[model samples]
Target: MAYWLFKTEPDTFSIDTLRLQKVACWEGVRNYQARNMLRDEIKLGDEVLIYHSSCKKIGVAGIARVVKEAYPDHFQFDPDSPYFDIKADPSNPRWMMVDIEFVRKFERIVTLAELKAIPDLENMPLVKRGNRLSVMPVSEDEWQTILHQE
Candidate 1:
């Protein structure tokens, strides 16, 4: 199965929230690249690292598993939704989403600084400057490296 890193604003959709909700639809991805990953790449049974971004304490907060395959994001059709798309047709959607179930929160967050320090992890997209794609592919080695880090 492919590995992935999914970035989120902790304040908006924290690992704690995922734990509480058990499973939730991962939506509101507006970036074309990220949206494409959701629509075409991410699949059921894929492992996702939940990275907390746009917060003071940015890091990998937990793990998750894709429980459902990609499907049209219903929010795209609702005018009241923040992610509403006027150009998106119901018959042919412009946005898609997947359901991820909570796995387990990390005992300690793997800070970005720590990620940057690791020689093997230096090539990871998360450690690269200005790389902000929310849904990104992760090499299996990189995935295991981060998981095994203290």
Candidate 2:
């Protein structure tokens, strides 16, 4: 299966929260590029690196496994929801989500600062200038290298 990196703000939904819940519906993705990756690329049984972004010590905090394939994001249909889209209809969704099961938290965070220092990750999108896709593909080698940092 393919490897992926999913970014979340630790204060909002940290790896610790995922560990407690065991599984969660990864929702609220409004960016079309990130939405496409959720709808088209991510699949059941795929491995994911839980990247903690927009918080102190931003980094890869843990691992997760996609337990369910892509499905329409219900939040898009709810008027009260922040993720709601007024133009999105029940019959034709404008967003999607996936269920990911908690796998394991790393012994220590693989900090972005450290990631940038590694030659093996030079080509990684995470280390690329201005790259901010919330969900992005990870090469097998890159996945292994990041896990190794723990």
Candidate 3:
């Protein structure tokens, strides 16, 4: 199964929220590249690193698994929702989402600062300058390395 990292603002949708919901539709991705990843790359049973971004201390907070494949994000059809898009239609959707099931929260947050200091992680997209994609693919080697790091 493919590995991935999905970032969410803690204030908006934290790891705690996922723990409570058990499963949730990962919606509101606006970037074309990120949307494409969800649409084409992710598959059922894929592992995902649930990351907390755009917060005081950014890090990988927990683990999740893809439970549903790509589908139109319903939030785009809701006019009252902050993620709504008038341009998207039910037939030809401009946005897509996937369902993820919470796995486990890390004992300690693997902070971005800590990740940056790892030589092997220097090439990671998360540590690169100006890199802001919320959903990104993670290499198997990189995935194993990060998970084993203290």
Candidate 4:
């Protein structure tokens, strides 16, 4: 039961989209570090904090649960897909994705400003400068602290 933060651009794939769809494949991760986390660390039944990034009201928007474990990201194999990788081989995948089911949408966002102001969350990667891995781990204490803001 690990905790994680998954960043998404609200316009690209918002919490609202997840809420509507119920379950969605978390794809388009290009970073090796983030890809590795999705492929190796994140697992079924894990909880996730849906963080809205690169948006006007950037913040933690909601919660989701990993309903399916990591598997090869099919988009990487499709030439028509923006995430397609020419170097990716079908026999050996270069990327992975997981299915996350919508859990809860917070009544209001827990703004980045508010998170940065929390002394206990100072160590969180999301609040740190230049630390932009889209998929990152969250400590139990940090998870509770962020949810407390909701």
Choose 3 or 4, whichever is better by TM-score.
4
Against the unseen true structure, what C-alpha lDDT does each candidate score? 0.93, 0.94, 0.92, 0.97
Candidate 1 ranges with C-alpha deviation above 4 Å: none
Look at candidate 3 and give me any clashing residue pairs: none
| Comparison by TM-score, 1 against 2, better one | 2
**Candidate 2 wrong stretches, greater than 4 Å:** none
For model 4, the local distance difference test gives 0.97
RMSD (Å) of each candidate, 1 decimal: 0.9, 0.8, 0.9, 0.6
Q: lDDT (0-100) at residue 121 of candidate 4?
A: 96
Q: Report the candidate with higher TM-score, 1 versus 4.
A: 4
Q: Give me the displacement of residue 12 in model 4, in angstroms.
A: 1.1
Q: What is the TM-score of candidate 3?
A: 0.97
Candidate with maximal lDDT: 4
- The collision pairs in model 2 are none
| lDDT digits (tens) for residues 74-124 of candidate 2 | 999988998889989888898999999999999999899999999999999
List the candidates ranked by lDDT, beginning with the highest: 4, 2, 1, 3
Clashes of each: 0, 0, 0, 0
Clash count for candidate 1 is 0
C-alpha lDDT of candidate 2 relative to the true structure: 0.94
lDDT of 3: 0.92
